[model samples]
Target: MYGNQWSTDGVVVARNGPSLVSYRFILKRSDDGKLFKCEAFDSEGESILESSVILEVFYIPKISFSPKQTLTVKENEQAQLICINDGNDQNATTIWKRQRTSTIVQNNCVLNFKNVKRTDAGLYTCIVDTKVGVYEDNARVIVLYAPTIDIEYFPSTKTMKCIPRGIPDSYMFKDWEHTTEYNDHLRFLATTKEGNNATLTIPQNVNKKDNNRERGIYICRASNNISSIDGTFAMQKYNLNLPGKPHFVSSTENTQYGIYLETTEIKIKFVSVPENTNYVVYKNGIKFTDYNESVLRNTKIIDTMYGKNVSVKGNILSLFVKLYTSEDFCWYKIAVKNVVGCSNYSIKLFSASLPGIPQILRAVPKQTEIAVLWNPGFHGGYHRWFIIEYRKVGDIYWSNQTTNSPNSTVIGGLQPVTIYLIRMFSRNRIHDSKRTEEILIQTGNVLMQ
Candidate 1:
């Protein structure tokens, strides 16, 4: 097979088969050309195949722009623009132009806009031209300026509001505020609302130095992907209100003596200005050291013994009396005092009964006498002496005697081998008491003289 010959400075962009031998080809012409026919031949130079294929040649020039859209600059600032073309031929040329310009400002593609003005904001395009084709692209450019801030102060609540201007939705507000040690304490709260506005609340509590100093400065900052804004505010002077004083109240109870003369639990009540102020309880005109938080909250003291013969005092000036006794006639008096105001109150504890009589000692039997001993009974407001009576076993009549000692007494004239029953009792001014248990005595087997 045979075909017409076509030629130019061309290169194979792609190929198939190994070792660059027995290969197929994808060719591109350095310069544009008209379609032509081609033929396939064997290594022997013989035409093995023939076909008419379109010989299309093209040059797709690639174009790119850096810092695409939205350029951020400070007030009265400058900026730079860059463009590039990655086409096969280095002879390709680039052109840069702004939206409203027919003539290209920079034919080199890299454009620099120095000392940029607000009017410089617009879309910019870059064009690349090769021997085969032309390519172009456009990018939007935005210029950003610094923002302003306004702060409002609320004196009564000690709060301030910070409003930022010129900050867009893509931007974020940042805090960079601080208060000196000698200055008032400040706290911050921030919120965002409609219209892309951010509000920051700052509360400052007046301190000693704040009263003397006329004002202070607080710094705040806002930032976005494009640029940043910083501002400061001067705080005004103001007075601080003080809290109110707490009130004190009082109550009391009777006193008592001994280990357990009175009930341990004592109740007291009070009122205050705040209504729910805390109260401290005291004991015996002193603070109750053993007071537990749980007991105070519950208003009941459990298992705690106000010591014997002691008084309970409360912070509110209430009193509690503790009572303990070993004697039937012993008595106690209780006094309570408020802890805060030192107010005093009192209550009495009393008990009445004949003192317990000593247990009678058993009698010792003798040949002609039987002896017994007992301590005298405690007679508080009662009779002093006790009567002793005895009767022989099987006898209906009793022989009576009297003694005042808490010591032993002997009965004579008793016959040997005789059994007797003896008993004793006391009669107080208040009442006659029952007799003690009768004692059984038997005489020894000895002759009586």
Candidate 2:
């Protein structure tokens, strides 16, 4: 076993015979696939023989995959993959590929996705090179998104859809219902699913309650394992029919109790009368449907209920009738018969005639007060005075003053640099006329007559 010398430094060389030599060294990852050489020289210091050998070192490349082997990401978010090699190789490169493509997308260790899209979902393979050999790994990416909703209406049905466009096509839905812009709940007729979409069907022949409820807000809810959302709309009818009904009440004294015996033309005013509408008058359970020119020509019959005439302008309907004391004790009603249907009867007892509204000429403002001038419109055959109402602009309450004169009056105790709204009307023994047209005025520095 005797070589000339058995020694170990960076490597160990042993010699036993004249022409026998051996070289040995510990194998390491850094020494893998390295070349080694030994040389022999003669006694004269001249090279005689030389030999060379290749060193083989073995090691497992520490392969690691980032973002795990399985992962999920939201739509429009960032995603990434990293392949790391912790082996003994100074020059190493990582290649990223999608699906089974052979092209290397990235040369660095990390694969960055600043903004991921729906088509970015798939398996990613990363190839890492090391001193030992080339290694590879895979990571799966998932993208989730909310459902998109759309609606369509037909002559006999309405269809609502909730469609999915993300990686996973699974979706759930809530029924249509009445909801605000914020909240969404499930409660409608029927729901069906096909492929990656959900649909809600509403038949036109639904119940009357449901039919009426359809005019309001309708909400549909769609959700998945990732997110929940809703869509809404307000249903309305474009074509409308049926005019609103009329309203009436007894006014001041003469008409307050009943029709006056001395009255000739009874002027009855009703509200809520739409424009261009024709109406029928009823007196003592008799319908006055005739618009005969001859009956209108006869002034004597015109003085009676048989000669009743109707006129509608804007929101007011005026009916002029002549009544006798015997017929005065009966009830009066009106019906708007033709367009769609007649409303219920609005009944009233004719006791007496009331005073009419006064016409306001003008309101003049002084330094600290105002002078209001007006003429009685139609007093309904009663003596009356003037009642003036005044208030500051934008004030909720009002102040009133009474004067015996029907023509004009002066109001004092006012302030300069102030604005006031004033209105005046005439009043008799029992009731007052509708207030006159409102007037606005500002006080000045000088008082006027």
Counting clashing residue pairs in each candidate, in order, gives 24, 13
C-alpha lDDT values of all predictions: 0.50, 0.56
- Residue 112 lDDT in model 1? 79
Give Cα distance to truth, residue 323, candidate 2, Å.
29
TM-score of 2: 0.41
CA lDDT for candidate 2: 0.56
TM-scores, all models, native as reference = 0.28, 0.41
Alpha carbon lDDT at 11, candidate 2:
55
Off by over 4 Å in 2: 1-18, 22-62, 129-134, 149-161, 165-172, 177-199, 203-219, 225-449
lDDT of 2 at 106: 82
Winning candidate number (TM-score):
2
lDDT of 2 by residue, 1-449 (tens): 22232333335355443466665656677766665655555665454665666765556677776766766787667877777767656776678888788877687888887887667778888787766688887878776665555444342445555454434566665555542112222234456877666665655433422222132235545565554333222122111111334323232112423345443333333333232245566765788642221112101111111122222121223344444556554555555433333333444544444567777787888789888887766655555677888999999888999987767888889898689998877777567777877888998887555
